[model samples]
Structure formats: C-alpha cells, structure tokens
Target: MEGLELTAFQIISAVGTARSCYIEAIQEAKKGNYEAAEQLIKDGDEAFVEGHDAHSGLLQKEAAGEGEHIGLLILHAEDQLMSAEGFKTIALEFIDVYKRFDAEKKEA
Candidate 1:
C-alpha cells in the first residue's frame, strides 16, 4: 500500500524466494548435483541481497530520525529474513556434507 508496508512486502517476497532457493539447493546437493546446488545458492544470494538492501533502507530511515511505527508486517518480514539466513547456513552445510559423501562414494 504505502511506504513501510510496501517495503516490508518487498523484503518478505525477496527473502521468501531466497529461502526456497536455499532449500532447493540442498535438494540438488542431496541428488549429487553440486553445480546446480551452487547455482541455486548464487540465485538465493542475489535475492537475499535485494531483501537486505530493502531492510537497510528502513534502518537508514530510522537513523535519519524518520522512524515509522513498526507494525506486525515489518516484524514478520524481519523474521522471514532471519529464517532465510538460517536456511542458507544450513543449506551450505548440507551441501558440503553431500559433496563429501559423493567424493567418498566415488573413491569407493
């Protein structure tokens, strides 16, 4: 609708896409598709940067004494952002483990 609301939606949408990409990346890694998994991680990083930039804009506004009322939507967007970050961490770890497994399998 308006400023804060629109920005919150943007954060949510971008991070949601990022979260999905991270999950899909894990799936690809599990299937031994390291290149695809890496590509998805790259895609997720791109989306995450978009959301992070949007969130930074809000922080900058607040720093400039242009703070607005923090609504539930904004709170939810922050939560989504945190969740996506956590998922990315997990995805990277999983990919590493899967890569190790694949390498060991090939050796065996």
Candidate 2:
C-alpha cells in the first residue's frame, strides 16, 4: 500500500480506539467510577492526538500541494475522525454531569 493509505489506516485505527475509550469513559462515569473515567478520557485524548496528527499531516500535504488522489477509504477515515471528535466532546460533558451527580450523592 502507499504511504497515504498507511496514514489513513493509522488514523482510522487510532480514532476508532479513541472513540471506544471515550465511550468507556462515559460508561465508567455512569457507574460512579470517576477515577477510571478520567483515566479513560486521558487515554482517549492521547489516542486522539495521534490520529489528529495523522490527519493534520494529510492537511499539510494538501496545503503543500501534495495531496494524494482522493479515495473512498480516505473519505471513510475523515468520517471516522469527525465522529471521534464529536464523541470526545460528548464524553467530556457526560463525565462532568456524572461527577456532579456523584458529588450530590456523596452529600446526600
């Protein structure tokens, strides 16, 4: 496969894993496992950075007028990246709400 193909694969793998991590974080928070939830969020961020970097590289390539011809797989990768980004935002908000609930429970 070509370098662009490899990069797209890497982005897909990393962002998919990040999405899973973000979901796991929300699940953990729902269970009141705030520590684990926070850890998962952190882990997700790390994975997201890796994926984001790969995506940015492609953008940079395009900016430099070196973009590979577009492909369906690359489009799929971009879709996954957007999904991951949205998931991360939702995960953070969910975690925050869970934390507040946990705090209220502790006080009650």
Candidate 3:
C-alpha cells in the first residue's frame, strides 16, 4: 500500500482508536470515574485530530486537481471517521449526564 492507500489505512487506524476511546470513556463515566472519563475524551480527541488531518490531506489533494480514484478502503475510512465523531459527541453527553446524576445523588 502506498500513497492514498496508506493514508486511508492511517485514517482508519486513528479513528478506530478514537472510537474505542470514546466508548471506554462512557464506560468510565458510568462507573463514576469522571476524571478517567475526561482523560479518555482528551485522548480520543487527539486520535480524532490525527485521522481528520489525514482525511484533510486527501481533500486538499482533490482540490488541487491531484485527486485519485476513491476506493472502498477510503470509503470505509470515512465511515469510521464519522462513527468516531459521533461517538465523541455521545461520550461527552453521557459524561455530563453521569456527572449531573452523581451530583443529584449527593444532594439527595
């Protein structure tokens, strides 16, 4: 794998890691480990940025008229990237909900 193929794999790997981190973050929040959950969110964001950067490179190439044929691999990578982004949003909301629940419990 070279060039576009290699870049697609990079995006897949980075976003895959981000997706896992976001899921794990939600689990941590469920267990009342807010700090760990927050750290995982940070980690996820870092991984997501790496993937986004790789994807952006492809976009820039296309804009510059250097576009290659988009293949199933690239499509899969984009799918994973979108999934990871969605997970990050869900994780943040879950963390907030968990924190609010914890606070309410404390008050009660």
Candidate 4:
C-alpha cells in the first residue's frame, strides 16, 4: 500500500464493487424487484465514481509530469474500471427490459 500501487488498489476495489452491484441489480430486476434493482444501480454508480476519481487523480499527476510507475496492477485496475462501466450499461438495459415485461403482465 504505497504510491501508485495504493491508488491502483483503491481503483480496483471500488470498480470491482461496482461490477458486483451492477450484476446484483440485474438479478434483482429479473426477480421483478425494480426498487431493489434501482438501489443497487445507485450503489454501483457511487462506487464507479469513486474509482473514476482515483483514476483521474493519476491522470492529473501524469499530466503534471509527476507520473507514477506503470505496472500490471494499474493495468488490471483500468480493466476493472472499464468492465464495471460496461456492466452498468448492461444492468440498465436489463432493468428496462424487466420493467417492460412487468408492465406488459400488468396490462394483460
């Protein structure tokens, strides 16, 4: 827990949490619990923002010529961030589809 490794770990933890939440949200939506799904989505977004902020700090430092050492851990953190972002998109889409199915059921 020092220097760039610390930051990378922070990013990885946050985004990994986000990805878990996003997947859980989809599960909740599948169960027709839209409220829970939405809450999970919110939670995921918060975690994603935290990770994004940590990543941004690194970018800022690099731009200021105080670049940190690049390593596989940092790359893994970036990969997790992107994966979480993609999961968020997928979760939202799944939620919408679930809602539509619920609506149709109610109308029938």
* Per-model TM-score versus the true fold: 0.98, 0.94, 0.98, 0.97
Judge candidate 2 against the unseen true structure and give its global Cα lDDT, from 0 to 1: 0.94
Candidate 3 stretches greater than 4 Å from native? none
Q: What is the lDDT of residue 69 in candidate 2?
A: 90
Q: What lDDT score belongs to each candidate, Candidate 1 first?
A: 0.99, 0.94, 0.98, 0.97
lDDT per residue for candidate 4 within 88-107, as digits (tens), equals 99999999999999999999
Clash counts for all predictions: 0, 0, 0, 0
Model 2 per-residue lDDT tens digits across residues 1-81:
768899999999999999999999999999999899999989999998999999999999999999999898889999999
lDDT of 4 at 105: 98
Cα lDDT of model 3 by residue, 1-108, tens digit:
799999999999999999999999999999999999999999999999999999999999999999999999999999999999999999999999999999999999
TM-score of model 1 relative to the true fold?
0.98
| Model 2: colliding residue pairs | none
Task: In angstroms, give how far residue 9 of model 3 lies from its true place.
Answer: 0.5
Tell me the RMSD of model 3 versus the true structure: 0.5
* Deviation from truth (RMSD, Å), model 2: 1.0
Candidate 4, run of 10 with poorest lDDT? 1-10
Tens-place lDDT per residue, model 1, 12-96, is 9999999999999999999999999999999999999999999999999999999899999999999999999999999999999
Off by over 4 Å in 4: none
Better-scoring candidate (TM-score), 2 or 3: 3
